[model samples]
Target: MTSDSRTLQIPEHQQDGAAQKSCYQKLSDEHVEELELYRKNGLHPVHLGDVLNNRYEVLHKLGHGTSATVWLCFDTQTSAWKAIKIIGASHSSDDRPELKFQLQLSRSDLVALPTDHFWLVGPNGRHVCLVMPPLGPSVSSKHQTMDLEALREVSMQAADGLAYMHRKGICHGDFRTGNLLFRLDSARINDLSKGDMLALIGEVTKIVVETDFGEEPGSISPRYLVHSLNTDIFADFITCQIAVIGLSLAFEITKPPKTSSVDLPYASPQLLLRLPPSTHSDVWALGCTLLEMQTGSVFGTAPFEIMQSMELLLGPLPKPLQRTWSRVYPEEMLHPEGNTEYLTWRSDVISEIKKHTRNADCLLKELAMSRKQSLKGLLAADDKNKPGSIVWQVPEKQVTQIGDLIKQTLSYDLHTRHTADAVVQHVWFDQARIHRKPRV
Candidate 1:
């Protein structure tokens, strides 16, 4: 489908007028998918009690993406829990590349694949429903609480999964920590009753969808929108294995898609330069993911900001792309003299320290003031205003090794960049393998 068709547009009759204003209702809650998208070729409306394929019974909403809504369902035939991803009518097709790639890798242990797929004839059109084994929350959502050792394991496993895919001539166009999910123990979850499952994952939260007018949603929209559940309650049951998912953008190395979407922060320099997606680009993305795991934050959020940060840290763009970069971004927007955001963050930290030291002895207050001055001096350094230039709190030795690996993978020249297989064999991962501990 063309991009224009997927754009949300309210009917012309409901554009302006008392009747038009009465046609729509605003939802106050946050994190819910846009209601305007629940029309025509957008989302396929699935209710809480709806039984799909006469086997999978909908239990609760897991989450929703731009083109699909995922649900937790009970499999009557298999007597197990499964996740069903219902793709929107516009994106769903029997010959879609995502489905084809999924079926090709169904037997691989490195990725999560649909066990079965069927079509649902909705009011809009046919929606492709994929049944999969339920997994835990993404690694990015839970990485903050994990210790260094746990982070190492996740990094190693993720790199290995990427290497496995690259070897099969596949490129995961959108490779990032958010696409890596922790594996859940299916044996334990399968034995739980519906009531027990609810107790474990918490009750489902929903709010009714009401229009200003009295028009019924019927098949066009869901009766109520379900809030996505947090899977932190199952943290203890998360296994060491991590599954690489979100294959909608994945494609064969021989044939790159005409267009693709990727998270800005994790997007490789090649992708940002409008170069074709390749296995090398995947390696660059993996580098960004590894750095995020170690730092607990992304390097930068905006495209220009990320580009500036990359230049500051990884040196200038390759000679071949320097002219392209200059053309794409104006010189005025390239780099600013100082970062107000960074200064504000430092100021807040200093204020907190002073507030805590107010009740301390004179020597303690003096020490706090000395520390504040030291921070100020650090900020005065040449690279202080650069994004992601803060000093890492990890041990010096560990930081050096991790930084070396990341630099190798994030090389400006794709020819010089490390491949996924080479990344898995890096010295840092070798050390990680030697010191890896079992997750409790």
Candidate 2:
């Protein structure tokens, strides 16, 4: 269960206590000391400029999250760069359906996995490390900027990856921007020379610093250089990865939807309320993410904010979810303006909601009320859809296409949501348009 307990092929004479202590020192970075107190399937600590088995040399600490510390490592043996994710024991049982799914396909059919895992003996103990091809910053990183064209490309590629996985019966449990990284070539950076775009990718690709902090013995943080990457490339790639993360979850392509925990803001209503996660749920999350990219803010400021936002803009939940919501916060159901579907108590719409959710039909009687809207009132001051508002700033043609595409994916009615394959075929992305070609 602990990496330290795992066997290492080091010779006994060389693996003395003092040597082991020294090795541990060499393997540490900013968070390594805290990470050294390893948890099961959790994060293992890492230091900057460390070397593993004299093969993979840690160049710089890239990033760290709850699960692992990622490093930009230089592979001495292959004379190339790679990403090394040093992880602990907690996720030992995390089912990576993609691995099995990939085996069934030819190399050409598969996109990259987050990382290809392996084990390495370190100063503290043995660690499970994932070795991946080197890449640049996260698309969600603060520096990223996206235009309409870039977003479309991102959506298309993401759909492609998800469609491949969905067809093989897998769901990406966690689909978010941080997990998606990109590598932009010199040619792409050149595209940025057009405007302030150059600033988004930063000044250069490589930088040699003593450490993320300052100078020390193991202080050499070797970052590589290629060309300054463009922000658009990062955005496009991230959108693609978001799709991949959704497909990575557990679900049979041909079966009913399943359920799992997800981030609060991006979580589908069903996921938030403990309902089964289906292809539709992923669509909902995608809608929220895309919206965030467009507006630079989440739909809600808090739990109540989300509920209020959904009721106002997206509509007052599918009948089943509404029924569940009404029970917990019965007060929320009493809308003075009659915001339950444009003041029309359409039995047919209720029937459809019921038909889609066979279980919900049994939970509540037909929802009958004059449809009124709370969202129009809340956002009345600056309706995002209006002409004078920021949303309207997007080119007219693009606004309709992008909004329609995202809305279709965010359809509150699960049945109305777009599937990954359907998303790929969307006219918004399929429509003909001029594209900038990179020489590289």
Candidate 3:
């Protein structure tokens, strides 16, 4: 790709919306409603033959979300491919202006933001159209699978990216697995060229979709690429997509809000409880996202279900949540009238499970001890009734270390939670660190 280094101001205005509207002006507003339906229900408003901003040609629809419909397009000026996010919301106020912020960020390692963004008024109204280098696939895209090492790399980089955003006072209020991108360049560590990486990807995902996100900047890969040479180049090929790609940021990336519907599965207890949002909440999102990237599921279906899962997987609610439980959660939410499991906590449970560790913070430790004792006792009682039943075991040491960090990320108390900066250095990422240390 050539360097169109023309001082990098935003692109000039696109082809006039009026000019484009003339062809369809004969159609009644009722007919236009049908056109609107094109994008509303997973159809492309612009045909493949159409051009955007007179500079971008619509290639195909990559994906769509609540706010905008994304199109893979060709940038005539830069002669590169870009993803165009056309905001569906009529007002421009809802769009994120961080494309400029992304271009100016101090860290070059972050490939999660687009190369550039600009606006275009459309037939509907003024739309804050974001033009950025394509983000390859949603981290949740069905075509890919990653092993543990690949996942670790993705987690560490994600944490580092979140740290960079938080330090800059930018809350990527909607950071989740789906928003993350995987860019594919040639796997240099594997000694594979760009062509090889492409071939590897085809073998991995098992189906060929459009693979181009952007060219890798140089022969040297980023720090996130330092994993043990994975055997399945196909998986890591998709994995390294994260290693060598540029990303885009669109809307709602402002100061952390009290709450937004966008933050699901990863929303912190504080935010869920209608408390003030903070940068630390982003840290919580990073943690929750890493867990889902591994587990491949949302935290739960509803708030109550999520709370139960978290309490079981991590420890109980921190003291703050406990204190407000009555005020915030109704009896139905805490213990649905028909669900006996919620009411079974008493002396019987205290005898079965033991405290996991004595090293947790005082509040966490006490809660952990109590919850575990109850859980263990209940399990023992069930076993006594059944005689010999299948046994359950705790996660191994390394896994427990990682689980502990995840719990810290999911901590109800911000004080007990792990910061994005610290999470990158956690023991869970130790193996990846060892590989990078020698080279650094």
Candidate 4:
């Protein structure tokens, strides 16, 4: 069932010689020749740009991963730009026939998502493109110096998206910043000019370069200009997309949390252990994202570092981060320090920040007066009665948020954990304040 095979219904003319060279009998000689040409020239299948795919004119290559190459193509019928990800037979370790079967399975999963789902998906009969609205510039927490309220909104929107994925029982296995796309509009941050923001957007939109006969036809060019300050539903759409990408990419891992799964940095304990992703996992990652947004750097070294720290301070990494981390570093990670070590380390980091920023009181005050005033609710309590007050509970949510993030993303467990779903519903999500507007 190679892409070139009759079983797949791919036209013979479109089949490449390289595809034929595989064990699958479906590949044509032409497919094999293409593979040979690529092998001879050290050109990857990804390098072949502007090839025709039925009615679509492939304009340029988007990005390449270990298993597939995505292209930004132009649909001749609708005259629209689309992303087409072509998974080649040679890319898989399995036999071409087996690979085809797996692709069929994956393709089915690809289409299972809802039409409004911002994540990737393929339409019926069409090869998987994972069509998404064009991406715009990202709102870097570090770059923009967001108030607490703005940060909370970003987190909430991200939670909503991740929760949606978990509800569908789909895991975004390879979440990253590059995968996130947003709407482009005019936004004024403080005194920053709208034109300045648009210029930044221009830098991030996927680039396209045309070619002739697999040869360099010309230089690369920008696809379009995205305004950053436009206020409308479109703007919210873009913001939501970025929020999704932000959650997915947090604490990306190079290895699985355990031998059987991949562990995302900042994943909850459950996620690190190869457990099904849940809201907890999403929360853990969001905490890390917020930290990154605040610190302007990727935190943590390896699973052991975070796991050891979290274990000493509290216990196992949160279920969410654990699930994702388990997939990356499956070798049984544990916290090194006991309770004292954990407590000391936690206190040190917080105290250090407070010392430098004067308890972040000024910042919080400004945030309370800004558009993010709703977020203060996260720090305050709903009621002073009952067993415990909101202040005490707020710390729990914050701790769980941070701990789960560290555990899920940096732990060694590979099973029995939460995922994006759990993270979304964590105390952190339930606690964050949502204000109408904060005074600037």
Using TM-score as the measure, the top candidate is 1
Worst 10 residues of 3 by lDDT: 218-227
Name the lDDT of candidate 3: 0.51
Off by over 4 Å in 1: 1-30, 330-393, 434-440
lDDT of 3 by residue, 1-440 (tens): 11122121111111222222222112232201222122211222444436887888764455554355666566667556566876653434433545545544536546445555566654344566676555455565531245556667777777877777666656666677776776543233235433443344342111111112332211111101111112233334343535222223322345445555545577777766767556666787777787676455556766666766666555566555756754676556655564645521222322221243233343233433433454456556755532232222223554566667777787777787877788888887888777643210
List model 4 lDDT by residue over 271-306, tens digit each.
544565433454455445544543333335555665
* TM-scores of the models, in the order given: 0.79, 0.61, 0.63, 0.44
Off by over 4 Å in 4: 1-49, 88-131, 137-147, 173-179, 184-264, 270-282, 308-440
CA lDDT, every model vs. true structure? 0.72, 0.48, 0.51, 0.37
Between which residue pairs do clashes occur in model 1?
Answer: none
Please provide, for model 1 over 1-440, each residue's C-alpha lDDT reduced to its tens digit, 9 standing for 90 to 100: 00111122334444223334234455555546766666677688888779999999998888888799999999989889999999989999876655787756755667888888999988767899988888898988766546656777789889988998888878888999989999898888798887887677665666665444544445576666777767767777778788999988888999987655888898787777676788887898898898777655565876568865665455555556767765665555444744433221234533543454321133223332443444345556666433222322344455566767777788887788998889888876776778765532
Model 1 residue 13 lDDT score: 44
Rank all candidate structures by their lDDT, best first, as comma-separated numbers: 1, 3, 2, 4
Best model per lDDT: 1
The predicted structure with the larger TM-score, 1 or 4, is: 1
Name the candidate, 3 or 4, with the larger lDDT value.
3
